[model samples]
Target: MKGLLPPPGAVRLLSIGGLVRTTGFGIMTSISVLYFTRSVGLSAAQVGIGLTIAGGCGIAASVISGRVADAVGARNTAITLVLIQSLAVCGYAFVTSFTGFVIAVSVVLSCHSAAEAARGALVAGLIPAEGRVRARAYLHSVTNAGLSIGAVSGGVALQADTQGVYVGLILACGALFASSGLLYMLLPQVEPVAAPSGRGSWEVWRDRPFLLFAGLNAILAANDTVLVVVLPIWIAQQTEAPLAVFSVVLIFNTLMVVLFQVRASKTTSDIPGGARAMRRSGVLFAVCFALWAFASGQPAWLAVVALLAGAVVHTLGELLWGAGAWTLAYEMAPDHAQGQYQGVFTMSTQLETMVMPVAGTMLILPAGSLGWLLFALLLLVAGLAAPAVARRHTNRHTNRQGTPSWN
Candidate 1:
C-alpha cells in the first residue's frame, strides 16, 4: 500500500504547499476587484480593461514560461516566476492609478500563468506516469480547501472595509505566494530532459492534433465559467430559485470536489480512459444545464429542486472533467516538452477565461432558457468529439513497435 502512493513526505509537503499557495489565491480571487474599485479608486470599467490586457499577457506568458521551463529547468523557472510574481502582487498595494494597476496586475497574471505551466512540467518530472493525475487530483482538493479558508478570511477584510486592512491582506497574499516559491525550493529537484532536436522551438504549435485537442479542452474548460460566473447570474435573474440557492449549490460543489475528486480520477488513469471520462462528463454537463434551463421561470420550489439536482450532477461532471483534462494533458505530452504542452493546454483555458467575462455576460445572461440550451449543446458536441480526437492521436502515434514509452 505504501509503495502504491507517492512518498508520504513528498505528499505532505505538496499538500501543505498547495494549501498555503491557494489560500492567498482564494483571497485575491474574491476581493481584488473590490480593493481596486473601493480602496484604489479605480472604476469598474478601468479594472475590467486592465484585466482584459492582463489576460492577454497571461495567455502569451503561458507558452513563454513553458518554453523557458524546457530551456532551463521547470523548478528553476517556477521559482523565478513566483518570486517575480510576489513582487508584482506587492506592487498592487501602491496601485492608485489605473496604469499602475494594469502594470502590476499584468506582471502578476503573467507570472501566475507561466508559473503554473512550469509547475506542471515540474510535477510531471517528480511523479511517476501512472500517479500524476491522482497527485493532481489530491492537489486540487488541497488548493480548494485553501481557497475556502481564504475566501472566509477575505470576507472578514471586506467587512472591515478600511483601506489599511485591504492593503494588509494584499501584502499578506504576496507573502503567501512567495512562501509557495520557497516550498518549490524545498521539493527535490527534477533533472531537465535534454532536448535532442532542433525542432525544440514551439514544437507544440506545430502538432495539429494537439491543437484540436486544445480547442476541445477550451470548450470543456468552460465548466469553470459555468460554475462561478454564469450560474450565479442565471440563478439570480433567469431562474425562479432563491439567490441563496447558488451559495448552497457552490458549497455543495466544493465539498463534493474536496471529498471525491481523487476517487473520480481513479477512472482516468490513461488516455483512452480519460477521453471516455470526458465524454461522460459532457453528457452530465448537458443534463445539468438542461435542468437549470428548465428551472428558469419555474415556481420557486420547483426551481430549487431542479437547481439542487443540477448541482449534484454538475459536480460529478466537474470531477470527471478535472481528472480527464489532467490525464490528457500529461499523457499526450512528450517527456521532453511537458512544459510546452501544458502551456498550450493552459493557454486554451486562459483564452477562454479572458473572453468569458464579456462573452458570458453579454451572450448568456440575457438569452435565458435558450442560452443555457445552446451552451449545453456546445458542451455535448465537444464531449462527443473528445474520444474521436484521442483515438486519432493514439492511432497516429502508436507504431507496430508497441506503445510509445514516453507516455
Candidate 2:
C-alpha cells in the first residue's frame, strides 16, 4: 500500500524501460524452448541441456558485469548489456544446429543476468537509499504486468503453433530488447564509485556472511519452483482437482503481486525488520504447502478451494520474501560496492532458476503429497534460521565509521 502510486520521473522511466525488457523476457520464456525444439528442430533434451549451460554462463557473467558497472558506470553497462541481448536474440534465427542454439542462448542469458547486476548498480546510483527498495518493488510490479502482456501475446503465437510464428515472435522480442536499451539511454547517469577500503573488486565472494545470507535467500526462492514447475503436476496427478485450478492459482498469484508488491517491499526498512519478514514468509510458505498437501484427497470443489487458499498464502509469503531480499541485499553492502554485491545476490537467484526445476521436482514429485510436506518443512527451517543468522553474521559487520553496527 505504501507505493501504490506511479513512481516519480526516474523510477517511472526506469519502469517503462524495464517493462519493455521484461515483455521481451516474457516472450522469450514463453516460446524460446518450444522454438528451439519444435521450430529449430533441436530435441527437447538438447534444448534443456543447452539452456542449463546458458544459465550457468549467465551466472558467471553477473559478477564480471557488476565489476564492469563499477568501473565504467552502471547506465552504460546496462545499456550495453541490453544491446548485446538484442543481438544475441536476433542470432537465434540463424540457429540451425544445437551448437548455434547454445551459443545464442548463452549470450542472451548472460547479457540478461549481467544487465540485472548493472541495473542494480544503476538504480543504487540514481535512487537515494531511502526510496530505493520501494522503487525497485514498483518496477517489479510493472515488470509482472509487462511479462503478463508478453506471455499472453506469446500464447497467441503458441495457438498458431507454426515455425514462422515462433520465429516471428523471437524477432519481435529482439526488437523489444533494442527499444528497452534505448530507453535506458534516457535515464540520468551517475559516476562509478570505488570499492570500499579493504575490499577487492570481488569482495562479494569473500564476504562469508553475505554468501550465507544469499544462500538462505536462494533456499527461500525454491518457492518459485513450487508454483511454476511443481504445482501444475500436483493439480493433475496428485489431486482430483481439474487442471483449471493451476490457471486460477497462477492468475491469483500474479494479481496479488501487481497489487501488493510495494506494500510487501515495505518490510525492508531495516535489517531486523527484513529478517522478521523472512521468518514470517517461511511460515506462510509452509502453511501454503500444507494446504496443498491437504488438497490431494479432497473432492474437486474442495480441492480447488484449498488450492486457491494455498495460492493466497504462497503469494503473501512471496511478497514478504522478495521485499526482505531486496532490503537485506542492499542494506548489508557498503555503498561503494553495491553493484558487485548485487551481482552476488543475482547469481544466487540465477543458480536457483537453473537447479530448482530438476531439484525441486526430485524432492516433491517422487513422494507426492508427502514430498510436498517435506519441502514445506525445508522452507520453514530456512525461515526460522533467518533471525539467528542475521543476528550472528550481521553483528560482525562494521559500519563505515568502523565500529560494530546492526546493534
Candidate 3:
C-alpha cells in the first residue's frame, strides 16, 4: 500500500484538497438541472442547451488556463481560478432570469473548468512520475468520498424551498472553493518545467497517439454522459423505483472507489501496460452497456438488480481506466509541456459533456437499439485500437531515439 501510494504528507494534502473541491462540485452538479428546470422555470430542452453552452465555455477556459499556468506558474494560476470559482458560485444565487442564469452558469462553469486544469497541472508538477498514477487514484478516491457526503448534505438543503435551496448550495460551494484556495496557497512551490523551444498546443495535437487517445476518450465520455442523463431518464420511465435509487447507486460507486482504488491502483501502476488497461476497461464498459440494454426490458425489481450489477462493473472499469488514462497522459507528455498535454486530456472529457446530450437524444429516438449497438461497436473499436496505436508510437519513438524497444 505504501509503495503504491504517494508520500503520506502529499497524499494527505491532495486528499483534503480533492475533498473540498469535489464536495462543492458534487453538490452543484447534482442540483444544477433541477435548479434550472424547476426552480428557475426553464424548459428541459432549454436546460440542456444551457448546459451545452456552459460546457463549451468550460472547454475554452480549460485551454486558456493551461497556457496561463505555463506563463504565470501553476500555483498562482490555481489560486486565481479558485477565487473566480468562489465568486461565480455566489453569482449563481443572484440568477433570477433565464439570461442571467445562463450567463452566471457559464461563468461558474468556465472558472470550475480552469480550476480543474490547474489542479491537474499542479498534480503533475508535485508528484514524481512513478507515484503519479497512485496519486491520481488516491485523489479520485477522496473526491468520490467527498462527493458522496456532499450529495447527501445537498439533498437536505435542497428539501427547503427554492430560495433557501439555492442560497444554501451556493454558500457551501463558496466555502469549499475558499478552502481549496487556502490549500493551494499552502502547497510547496513547485518550479515550472521550462517550455520547449518550438512546442505549442497545435504541435501536441499533431501527435498521432495523443490524438487517438483523445478521440477514443471522447467516445467513452459520451457514453458516460449517457449514463448520467439518459439512463436516469430511462429508469424513471420504466421503473416504480424512487428517483433516489440513482443516488444510491452513485453512493455505492463512490464507496467502491474509496475502498478499493488504492489497492487496484497499486497492482496496475507499474505494469507499463497503459494500452492494455484501456482495452480492458473498454470491454468492461461494453459489458455494462450490454447489461443496460437487457435491463431496459426487465421488470422493475429485475431492472434494479441489473442496474446495480452494471453500476458495480462500470465503476470498477472507471477506476482502472481512469488510472491508466492519467498515467498515459503523464508519460506521453513532454516534461516541458505538461500543462498543455494535461489540458488537452481534460478538454476531451469536457467535450464529451457537450456532445453527450445531443448524441444520446438522437440514439434514444426512433432507432434506440441501433444507438446501443453503435455504442457497443465504438467501445470495441477503441479497445482494439488503443493498444495498437500505443505500440506503434512506442516503436517509432524508440527508433528515433535509438533506445531499446522494451524501454
Top of the candidates by lDDT: 2
Per-residue lDDT for 1-407 in model 1, tens only?
34223357555567677788889888987789999999888899999999889989999999999988887788889888988988888898888899899999999999989987887888888889998898888888887789999999999779988889888998999999899889888888777787667864888988877888889889988878888898898888887788998999989988888888888889887888888888888999999989998888889999999999999999999999889988989988888889899899889877778767677888877887888889899998998888888877788785535562222
Model 1, C-alpha of 240: deviation from truth (Å): 2.0
lDDT of 2 by residue, 1-407 (tens): 44566666888888889999999999989998888888889999999899999999999999889888878888999999999999899899889999998899999999999998988888889999877888888887888888999999898779988988888888999999999999989888878786657767677787777888888898899898778888898888889899987988888898889999988887578777778888899999999999999999899999999999999999999999988878778878777888898888888767788888887678788787889899899899988888776776567764334433333
Per-model TM-score, in order, reads 0.95, 0.95, 0.89
lDDT of 3 at 394: 66
On the 0 to 100 scale, the lDDT of residue 327 in model 3 is 66
Local lDDT at 138 for model 3: 81
212-300, model 3: which lDDT tens digit per residue?
77777666666567667777776676554556778777677767778787766665543246666777778888887766666666677
> 2 or 3: which has the higher lDDT?
2
Show pairs that collide, candidate 2. none
Better of 2 and 3 by TM-score: 2
- CA RMSD (A), model 3: 3.1
Ranking by lDDT: 2, 1, 3
Q: lDDT (0-100) at residue 206 of candidate 3?
A: 75
